[model samples]
Target: MKKEEVPQDESCFSDTEMKEVIYAVDKDGKYDKALSSGWETKTIVLDKSLEHIEERKAQAIANIKNGIQSPIAYFMEEHRMDIPTLASYVGIWQWRVKRHLKAKPFQRLSAKTLQRYAEVFEISVSELKHPKF
Candidate 1:
């Protein structure tokens, strides 16, 4: 692709100062770097990915409401984190974290453990325990 032909379509980064670096051919056919806001195909794929994430988040919230999962599950999806990542951040074992995703085990958690989760989610312990869905 030619430098001038580099895509500059508006995308998720359109409201930000970020740009995608793309390599293209300049006027003399020399390879050059071009900064693009984004491209259509990439934006479409990103939109789809975000939609999927949102769907998962909603499912988590639903599970919490139905008592099948704990608030930790909802917050995990909200923060776009997986069990292992949440466990590492909270300095807990992955298996323990997985168990806490269930309501019974989550209710049995100590204040210190809840505080750790609150800190990772950047919320108060109260908020972590009583998530607003």
Candidate 2:
């Protein structure tokens, strides 16, 4: 985008936070330097991303409450992980991780398997099985 379109607002960032942006410094467009400042456009994009995450969290909570899925799904979102990523972390296959996201399958999981998930989430098995929120 053009320099004119770049946002100069700092409302989304704190006084201590800053973003580095490279800009052309010469008419020949060969020189560049990093300017430390907040970009409103970046802030807007970050806000939208956070909003999307919140929406997903709400849906995960709803699914858990309705007994359509397990708390593992919620923890997955909380950790910003997809099935494959979580499976890799837990040293399991993606399909098995997906199965663990289901309420029935998760309920039948062995303690050893639950420990794997709990360790990845940095929580206890009890907390993993019954999340507070």
Candidate with the greatest lDDT versus the true structure: 1
Error of 2 at 15 (Å): 3.5
Compared with the true structure, what per-residue lDDT tens digits does model 1 show for residues 107-132? 99999999999999999999998988
Question: lDDT by residue for model 2 over 30-126, one digit each (tens)?
Answer: 5555454676777789989888888898999999999999999999999888788999999999998899998999999999999999999999999
* Model 2 TM-score, all chains together: 0.85
| lDDT of candidate 2 at residue 102, scale 0 to 100 | 89
Candidate 1, lDDT over the whole model: 0.92
Q: What is the Å distance of residue 101 in model 2 from its true position?
A: 0.5
Off by over 4 Å in 2: 1-7, 11-13, 26-30
State how far residue 116 of model 1 sits from its true place (Å): 0.7
CA lDDT of every candidate: 0.92, 0.84
Ten-residue region with minimum lDDT total, candidate 1:
44-53
**Reference-based lDDT, residue 4, model 1:** 94
